[model samples]
Target: MRFCSRWVVRDQWHEVCLYEDYFLYRTRAADSTAPPEEHRVENGDIADIGVDREGPLWGITLTVTSGESRTVPCPATIAAPLLLRWHDRD
Candidate 1:
């Protein structure tokens, strides 16, 4: 699943995606003059996952074992299932 937010004033788009085995985050700005920044983290390397409610969107934060952290915006439907599934594996 994927979700995006736009920063109009900065002309930037921020996005996050969760796949079966990885998480992806991306951002694009300035009319794509430069390449969009992307980050990927494997499921096995994720140390922790968390959620916070902000209206209808959930802020899903992933912390990696190597110390990088990212917060991805997602809906409740995707957030809860991901949390459950990840913990179940461990």
Candidate 2:
């Protein structure tokens, strides 16, 4: 499966993509030639999901089974659907 979406982190927008088994994300300035940062997580790797409020912007926190966590700012409109997709996997 493959999916891509833009997310905000530290007030900057980034492109986040999930292709096959990799969760790849990178800054817009990085461009296509730049090597993107990759994260490895299977369906069950995600252990928890939570909403984070930063003023008017909404974000999400993902806790992995290994106890590592990552936070990314996402619009409320996309949060539910995205989280639901992951939820359905487990």
Candidate 3:
């Protein structure tokens, strides 16, 4: 996968959006219109990551400081590209 852009805010993970010809993988604000927060990731930190693709849906794991992870389905706009790019990955 190739990343079109990456962002960090306030020294923590804010969002990451990876893009290809037909797909985009993004982690964005829940409100859609809210300004992105400031976070940063330093070296040696264990960043937990998860990805899921089922049927027409795609999901990614969201990890909090508490160690619990939540899998959230990608929105339709994102799902379309995800599926297209995933097949390309193969």
Clashes of each: 0, 0, 8
The runs of at least 3 residues in candidate 2 whose Cα sits more than 4 Å from the true structure, single-residue gaps closed, are 7-11, 17-33, 53-56
The residue-by-residue lDDT of candidate 1 on 1-90, one tens digit each, is 433333322465655556677767677775776777988888788888889977766777889999878775666666777677656653
lDDT of each: 0.69, 0.63, 0.44
TM-score of 3: 0.35
Model 3 steric clash pairs: 9-38, 9-39, 10-38, 10-39, 11-39, 11-40, 12-39, 12-40
Task: Output the worst ten-in-a-row residue range by lDDT, candidate 2.
Answer: 22-31
Model 2 residue pairs with clashes:
none
Q: What is the lDDT of residue 62 in candidate 2?
A: 69
Each model's TM-score?
Answer: 0.56, 0.61, 0.35
lDDT score at residue 45, model 1, on the 0-100 scale:
88
State the RMSD for candidate 2: 3.5
The whole-model C-alpha lDDT of candidate 3 against the native structure comes to 0.44
Greater-lDDT candidate between 1 and 2: 1
Off by over 4 Å in 1: 1-37
Flag the better candidate by TM-score, 1 or 3. 1
lDDT at 77 for candidate 3?
Answer: 47
